[model samples]
Target: MEKIAQPQSSFMKLCRKLSPKRKDSAAESQHIKNGDHDKNRHIEAVFAYMDANKDGRISPDELQKSFMTLGEQLSDEEAEAAVRLSDTDGDGMLDFEEFAQLIKGDDKCSEEEKKMELKEAFKMYIAEGEECITPRSLKMMLKKLGESRTTDDCRVMIRAFDLNDDGVLSFDEFALMMR
Candidate 1:
């Protein structure tokens, strides 16, 4: 049998109440024109992939750890807040249904748009319009983001995602890390 979306939890209701209604712009209209079926499937797959333990729900701890893996340090409170916003079943965790519902209304960007955004972010890590990021530049950038890492640590971090083994991070490598 097909599962139905759960009734919205109080947290979800409150989020709805606080969220301002956006007037759809040209971009929003274009997004609507592009079908969301594939996007929905992708979101579902991602949710399942993130649920790591196959527990049918994602805990705040899992979310926090995932953020850390991506170099984003989230405080316990911040992680809990994120879970609360999406926990539409009042279970303190997110099932696939709740996850789907939570992201169903999101403005899903096109692959091209995503690439462009990644490229723009990659540009920020480059110096003097250089095409790639050296370990020194990467360390400086990470330091700017409040992450204190030694040059060796930065090199290690780059090598972790540096597919070409060129001793630096290219735009493609950076995009892979971002994705």
Candidate 2:
């Protein structure tokens, strides 16, 4: 049997409209490079894991349970509110696309807020008073996160987004890499 194609959600449409166009083939290729591909796959894996009972949709209970598994407590009201925020179909459950939107966060977040959050995350890998992230810092952060990687591997990762040909990642370069 042929599978039916789902309609695009308004959130996705807005994202496409707001996102920048690729400059060239190289830019397009880099956009889908290994790290991004792995991130997307990881998101799918998490969503699948959260959707208990083998259902395509995630109910509020399932979402709450998933949060508990991660050692985070989520109230029923909060879970329901989260589902309502992204439930375009009013089904009271989240399909994969809706879940993705929830994961990305609501549209209410401002650009400045996003930048602040990114800066905080970036700071986690850098030393005090340091403005750039070096390979040593990146490798140390990755190790702390349970993903062991060599300093050379971290250096190559930074080189991919090192726009100024610098050996480290400044905030601007890190922001671009996050995108």
Best-performing candidate as measured by lDDT: 2
lDDT tens per residue, model 2, 90-173: 999999888776655533455765566556556766866778999998887656434678999989988999999889999898
Would you estimate the TM-scores of all the predictions? 0.45, 0.49
The per-model lDDT (C-alpha) reads 0.59, 0.63
Clashing pairs in 2: none
Model 1 agreement with the true structure over 57-161: per-residue lDDT tens digits: 988787666545434455687667766776877889988777766655333545664465456556656676578988888777666544678999878978898
- Pairs of residues clashing in candidate 1: none
For model 1, the run of ten residues with the poorest summed lDDT: 1-10
lDDT against true structure, model 1: 0.59
Off by over 4 Å in 2: 1-40, 46-101, 105-108
TM-score of 2: 0.49
